[model samples]
Target: MTNKKQRLASVDALRGFDMFWIIGGEALFAPLLALTGWSLFAFGHEQMQHSQWHGFRFYDLIFPLFIFLSGVTLGIANKSLQGLPLENRWPVYRKAIKRLLILIGLGIVYNHGWGSGIPADLSEIRYASVLARIGFAWFFAAMIVWHFGPRAQYAIAAAILLGYWLLQVGFGPLTPADSVNSWLDQCCLPGITYLNRPYDPEGLLSTLPSIVNALVGVFAGRWLRQKAGQHTNILVGLAAGGLACLLVGLLWHRVYPINKELWTGSFVLITSACSLLLLALFYLLVDRWQWRYFNYFFAVIGCNAILVYLGTSLVNWQYSSNSLFGGIAAALPDAAGTLVIACGVLLLQWLVLRWLYRREIFISP
Candidate 1:
């Protein structure tokens, strides 16, 4: 429940770590495996990227974890709000709403465009997106946290996941390829269903479970903010929560199948657990151990994550890559454009974040 000034370094580090993957694939270990003649689309890499209709993968866990972390941060933010009088809550609420709106607007702008050569068909524009889902989930969860206490918020989150699971299993129709859940996505999302080409990673129906993920973090955040030794509390909470998630996810996987696209109850459990574990690990290493160097790089990127994503999407980094290291890569022979683009994007985002950080300007949602 610490204020912005008292925010934990571990949270920032974790946020930065999450953004590293999203900003570019190369910064992560995935590209290394791919470079070693392992096809990211073959075997596990494809699974890591996403499940086709059903099943789970390491990559599927990433987005939900981020949402969960956001929820945790919300709890912390809420605690900080306690010192402010009742009169000040209105302004905080306004700020939260504005952040959500800006995130949604950015999501739309990233998908659609205000410039020439924009696709004429409105329906073709990707409506459901990652930022949109996060914004919606964060806004709703924040409202719940703001109104009801943390206990109530947790109950609401659990209800959501369980309810979604029951609905998908008990009432949803069947599909020929997978199970009823996959079919449910198509049936529920219908017109907005991601049909291929350029698809929405965060679609409409999936947002339900995503909201729960964020709420879980909210609960964690509230717990962490309690008056106690930070390290012990974080470790215990993360361990317990993560273990519970892993166990529940594994058990539920049998019936529901841990499908990322469907955002099954099991998937939510598993990802939340992973997120908790990751936060614990980061907290232990960066905060507890007082490691400074590794964090600065990620903190920079984490601070301006949204801006970095938008910049990369709007402005091409290919020219920048070519201008800097293209010739060196070309001389090496058979360098994939994907690798080059990934590297360029990482460097560009890093530099931008570093610059912004130096100016004490943080673009947060």
Candidate 2:
């Protein structure tokens, strides 16, 4: 099915909700703990924090969800590339590679300050990053879409996940010092890693499985397209699929272990399942029921998702925001000051995006 050239506001809304947590919602919840003094709100704060090593949390879902959304876009846009010949598709592949390189550059810069002209110390650069992970997942997923039809995409996803699982298991008896994933990083990307750790969470080896996560998203998107206008069917299918993934993932955790750092097959399934369910929800509320007003702010951020993400780094709005609003917030009690700062910064970010949205100045890579 050809997606309308017009944007899907539901997609935008779901993306914006995901971005909200990273941009400010994560910060917002902590202060609520101080203000509300251990109510249901406290639970939100806890979920915002990542799990120590293994298991999952709401925060852990965010990264995989981003990859999943990429797949959704792929499925939604499949019509555009559906009939093109392999030779005709070279330009599109070039653009994708270009975007991937740019994302990698941005990830590196995000880790090392631009003012210092990138640290001479090689260790300062973190090549394995969220942006880099997204790039890898998106690149392969797009290639899959480019070469194969919907059926092949599913087969490819299964292969990727199963292959990665075998790799981890076949490598045998991994200790923390000898983690296969960690070893791949040390061997491949010599100078850079995250937090000076031996193994990066977004490490090279684990990235193979991450692509499967994106493929799952692609599958979900294709399903949505096939079932368009059948609201009840879509929601029921998403729920059933999500529950199956969650149950299988939990069962597989017995042998494989659902480690986000590893990007285990189980993690991919479970997280992708959650993302599918979440997408169904936003679709039902905003697109199906037409309850769009409530998530209007979310759509604003969603329009220029990457713009706001990079803007936060490129422009130090946080420092300026703190100078403007921190004093008042500081007068408040524990963690409230930080929350106020976060709110102020988020508002500033939103207004800037809102202005850009008004002018239709979306920054697309």
Candidate 3:
């Protein structure tokens, strides 16, 4: 059966919320811990930082959550194309491929490739990047959604997580130098700049399990797209699903351990649970109950998430922020000055996104 494109403000708002942290929210808010010296801010600032080697953190959730949200969007978008002839779906498939390629290219650019000057050796480039991982995971997950039924998609996600777990267990210990994930990266992506020497967090093998993150999002997206008037039931189901995943993930952690760097199976389930619960909360507030006053700021950014992400990389926002607010910042104390500048940087980025959102220019990939 065909379905119309259901515009879920919560989805966009959530996307923007996730992007907010990446772009400037972390910078803007992290200073609060220093300024106010509040325990809450201290706790939040701690969560903002990534876990060094193993363990999960709120910051670690950012990347996988974005991928899952992309899956949710895919599920929402494909609604219109659901019953179309196979031939008719080619255009979307092409678009997905194009997006994947563009993101990969952009990922390289984000890594500061050849921009300064092409390295004498290609090995100098960081082949695996946060954006590249997102692109790859989203692309494969999209292909699965395009070609398979929900049952098959679920099975595929299960097989991927389980298979990856087996590979990690059977091949080597979960150490940076000795883990199978690192070994695969060393063998296959030779010369790639490893984020952690000899083992990039966005390495090839770990990406296999990452696809399940997006698939979980697809499941949520499909569930959300169901017929209207069942919002409460949907909320309960989402909460229950999230809690169940959390439980399973904790149990698995005993064996595999929740390692964000390795993107362990337990890590996937834990993050998926967090993503689902977050989605449920947002849907409940913004879509179901219509508490949208606070969401507009984020929704504006959400409307143009990809644009802002690339813009932050390409545009010298910091220079602009300092230029506009430097005098004010200069007048304040050190901590306060830093906060002002951060706020300015965030404001500047948001204005750019707001302008695009107002002009109805939403750039997605």
Best by lDDT: 3
Question: How many clashing residue pairs appear in each of the predictions shown?
Answer: 4, 0, 0
Write down the lDDT of every candidate, Cα atoms only. Answer: 0.71, 0.79, 0.84
Query: lDDT tens digits, residues 1-365, model 2?
Result: 22332226778888888888877678777777777787777888889888777788899998998888888888777745667887877788789999999888777766652333443656545677788889999998888887777778778888888888888888865444467887788888755667667788888888898898788877777777777777788788878888888898899888888778778898888898899889888877876777757568888998888776777567887887888998898798757787789889889988988999889888766
Lowest lDDT sum, 10 consecutive residues, model 3, at 1-10
Candidate 3 residue lDDT tens string, 251-345: 99999989998999999999999999999998887777777665788899888877777777888888998999999999988889999989898
Candidate 2, TM-score vs. the true structure?
Answer: 0.91
In the range 86-188, model 1's lDDT, one tens digit per residue, is 7889887898889888887788678653323454455444556678788988888887877786567778888998888877777544233344444544555
Ranking by TM-score: 3, 2, 1
Provide TM-scores for the models.
Answer: 0.84, 0.91, 0.93
In candidate 2, stretches whose alpha carbon ends up further than 4 angstroms from where it belongs are: 1-7, 79-86, 113-124, 334-338
TM-score: model 3 vs. ground truth: 0.93
Error of 1 at 209 (Å): 1.6
Candidate 1 total steric clashes: 4
The segments of candidate 1 whose C-alpha lies over 4 angstroms from its true place after superposition are: 1-7, 27-48, 79-90, 113-121, 173-193, 196-201, 335-342
lDDT of 2: 0.79
